[model samples]
Target: MIPIKIPREEKLEIIANIQNHFYREMSDEIGDLAAENLLDFMLKELSPHIYNQAIKDARTTVEQKMMALEEDLYALEKPIR
Candidate 1:
């Protein structure tokens, strides 16, 4: 759960690491079978959990950012404009 904002290229590298370390441990055929199972698990179980958590986190972060932006805008505005 490290929250790091990375560029798209770095994200791909992270994904490659995940696949190489975790998924690639199995044989190709077995990995394919497991991938289908993993996809089903994600759709049925993992996705809801991830989606809900992400939504909650995003809402909080966006709210905080919006408030900060509003404060900055107010500070920057010209009087009686």
Candidate 2:
């Protein structure tokens, strides 16, 4: 799998959030560079699992829609004389 590359703006936002959470919850001050490194590590470790789950979700949705379409097509069948 290709490495997941987050947009620069979004990455910055997430890093800021991580920094805030550390300060609020852990009472630890994390610098911007530390937060960015942490974000990079998390994305590398977690993105593949997240990507797989998203694909599974999309496949389920498509299967349900296909079933519904089949039912609708069956309802349109003409009765034999």
Candidate 3:
């Protein structure tokens, strides 16, 4: 799978959130660089699993819609004399 690439501004926002989480929860101050590195690591390691789950969700939704469409089409069929 291709690497997930987040826009620079969004990446910055995520890094800031990570830093804040660490500071608030862990009571440890993390620098911007450290936060960025951690973000990169997480994106690399976790993105594929997340992407696969999203695909599964989309497939299930499409299958359900297709079944509904099939029922609608069957309802429109003319009755045999």
Candidate 4:
């Protein structure tokens, strides 16, 4: 699998958020490098699962639409004598 490469701007934002969370929630300070490493770790470990779940969700939605379309087509049939 290809590595997730976040843009520098967005990565900086995420690192800031992580540092803030550590300070507020854990009352511990996290350095910029530590926060960035944590972010990279999460992306590597969690992104594949998240991406797979999203594909599953989209597939389910398409299946539902197909089923509804089939039913609608049946409704359009004329009654036979």
Local error of candidate 3 at 67, Å?
Answer: 0.3
lDDT for each residue of candidate 4 in 1-81, tens digit (9 for 90 to 100): 788788999999999999999999999999999999999999999999998999999999999999999999999999999
**Every model's TM-score:** 0.47, 0.94, 0.96, 0.88
Is 1 or 4 the stronger prediction by lDDT?
4
Ranking by TM-score: 3, 2, 4, 1
* TM-score preference between candidates 2 and 3, better one: 3
Q: Model 4, which residues run further than 4 Å from truth?
A: none
Question: In candidate 3, what are the lDDT values of residues 6-59, reduced to their tens digit?
Answer: 999999999999999999999999999999999999999999999999999999
lDDT by residue for model 1 (1-81), tens: 323345767655555554565645753333444544554454566566777899999999999999999999999988894
lDDT of 1 at 70: 97
Worst ten-residue run, lDDT, model 4?
1-10
lDDT of 3 at 54: 99
Candidate 1 matches the true fold with a TM-score of 0.47
lDDT (10s digit) by residue, model 2, range 1-66: 898888999999999999999999999999999999999899899999999999999999999999
* Candidate maximizing lDDT: 4
Give every collision pair in model 4.
none
List, in order, the clash count of every candidate structure. 0, 0, 0, 0
**Full-model lDDT, candidate 2:** 0.95
